[model samples]
Target: MRTMLVADDDPHIRSLLRQVLTGEGYQVLEAADGLEARERLEAAPVDLAILDVMMPGLDGLELCRIIRDTYDIPIILLTARQQLSDKEQGFLQGTDDYVTKPFEPEELLFRIKALFRRYDVPSLDKIRIGRVLIDRRNYEITAGDETLLLPVKEFELLAQLAQYPGRLFSRSELIERVWGLDYEGDDRTVDVHIKRLRQRFAEHDGSFRIRTIRGIGYKLEAGNA
Candidate 1:
């Protein structure tokens, strides 16, 4: 069974998430704040985390940075702030997805399911495409002697493309598989992440490329095949 940790200062939010996740067949762990959540994470591994932005100490952003630095677990941030800058910051800080405070529970559940379906435990250890090595367990990507630290979305998008080399995926399809079908963002986000991934690969003298299908979308080229 997959385990999920819910960290929120609001008792109401914690209870609601627990009820919904439990019904969806997930083992739920609850924490009232960032400090408590950190302790829980240290004691046991969780497949995903639902973090609230406003907390007594550490804060969701800080906690997320710590989690990203320490573990490869997926994170979905919950915040009342609806600013684009806030969302971008969360994504840049290694959050896999973001949910606004007045969110639909079903949307959150859908995102969780989407993430699990794509990057479950069985595929979490390592993913290799030609000479490019993605250590999903450690969140490290290596091409020959150079290792690259990818942001969360970049890693997820690359992993999805790697799963089926040479298979094209439209922007909508990539958004559905990687950012969740219910994600409320523009398709431009996918393009931005792909651009970043290509830059990282180039820095390491790696030619493992994501092919653009012009009006369609993208595909991972078989660099060694």
Candidate 2:
């Protein structure tokens, strides 16, 4: 059976979600706050999580980041705030969907079904190599407690290599896939970005390193992180 985790500080809301989801033939997991949710999340195979934005400890956004950095699971935020900025922040933190509070149970159920159709939720979003997490979805590189944000092109370049660890990509292919034809610089530009990316990861003490394939391109290799 498909599993869904419902996390909220309020018992009534949790009960409501459990009732709604359970009736729809989903096995429901319950957590009172983000911390408890994380504990439960780490212990089980949860298909999806519905999280309240405000919670004791971690909070929903922080929990969402951790989940995105390590798991393939899809997330939906349950919040009272309807502001566009708040929703945008949730998305940047790696949440896939959002439903404001006081929403109809049936509508929420429909949204969950739609997300399942859109995303291959079982497919991993972030690639973990030892202590470092290469998060392609959010353009985030996280190692332990530290998280680094990279420029779009640099992030895409890193993500491209991460998608197929140890696979070689020629400089031309990297430019075409990451920089695109719109890029005005020569192949040296790829080397320049690679150097900068390496330096940035070094500063963050990442466990993985990008290895040059001599005359070919580059690949991600995990050393003593």
Candidate 3:
């Protein structure tokens, strides 16, 4: 089932959303505030997010920007405000759609379906190396029974390598693929993230290893499980 997050400060609103979303067969996750919503996202991935604009602590626009920078998912902003500036800000922050308050549940459901169709939702791109499972759909890695969520860049870097085990990738390629072709940062950024990934997985049983190709780049190889 596709998972959707509904974040709002009002309990009644959250409850109503949960009902409407669940009735449509989408699994619903809720957060009472913006910060809690962020925590929920980091711990578990959702296919789409519906965020209230007036949320306390890390409000919707800021949260939308943060999520957009990290995950490839659709976001819809819900607000009572009808100001054109508010709508513009939401779009600038990367919201896929904006829904005004007191909307018909049916209308919201129709919008949700349209977004799903547009984005081609429900695809899982996953790779397995020994006991490790890299799930691109959820932006999560599972090693045996433990699930780990890495920083967005770290996860993307690792996912790229895991997708083609034993295939070498140059720093330039990695930066282009993971950090985007427009990134203007130092190439050593890859080196720093790779180091962190190594440290993060050092304690796990040998299910996979990322090997540096000295002067060239890196590759992922299946290890003893």
lDDT of 3 by residue, 1-225 (tens): 678999999899999999999888889999988999998776554779999999899899999998887566789999999999999999999999999998998999999999989888443498887888889988989988999999999998988887656555778778887999799897999999999999988976488888887777787777878
Model 2: what TM-score?
Answer: 0.56
- How many residue pairs clash (N, CA or C atoms closer than 3 angstroms) in each of the candidate models, in the order given? 0, 0, 0
- Candidate 2: the clashing residue pairs are none
Off by over 4 Å in 2: 121-225
lDDT of each: 0.83, 0.82, 0.86
Clashing pairs in 3: none
**Using lDDT as the measure, what is the rank order of every candidate, best first?**
3, 1, 2
Name the better of 1 and 3 by lDDT: 3
TM-score of 1: 0.55
Between candidates 1 and 2, the lDDT winner: 1
**Against the hidden true structure, what lDDT does model 1 obtain?**
0.83
Task: Please estimate how well model 3 matches the true structure, expressed as its whole-model Cα lDDT.
Answer: 0.86
Q: Could you give candidate 2's per-residue lDDT for residues 1-225 as a string of tens digits?
A: 678989899999999998999999999999998999998775555778999999998799999888887556679999999999999999999999999989999999999999888765434779887787878777788878888888998988887776655445678778887888788888888899999988887754457788776666776665566
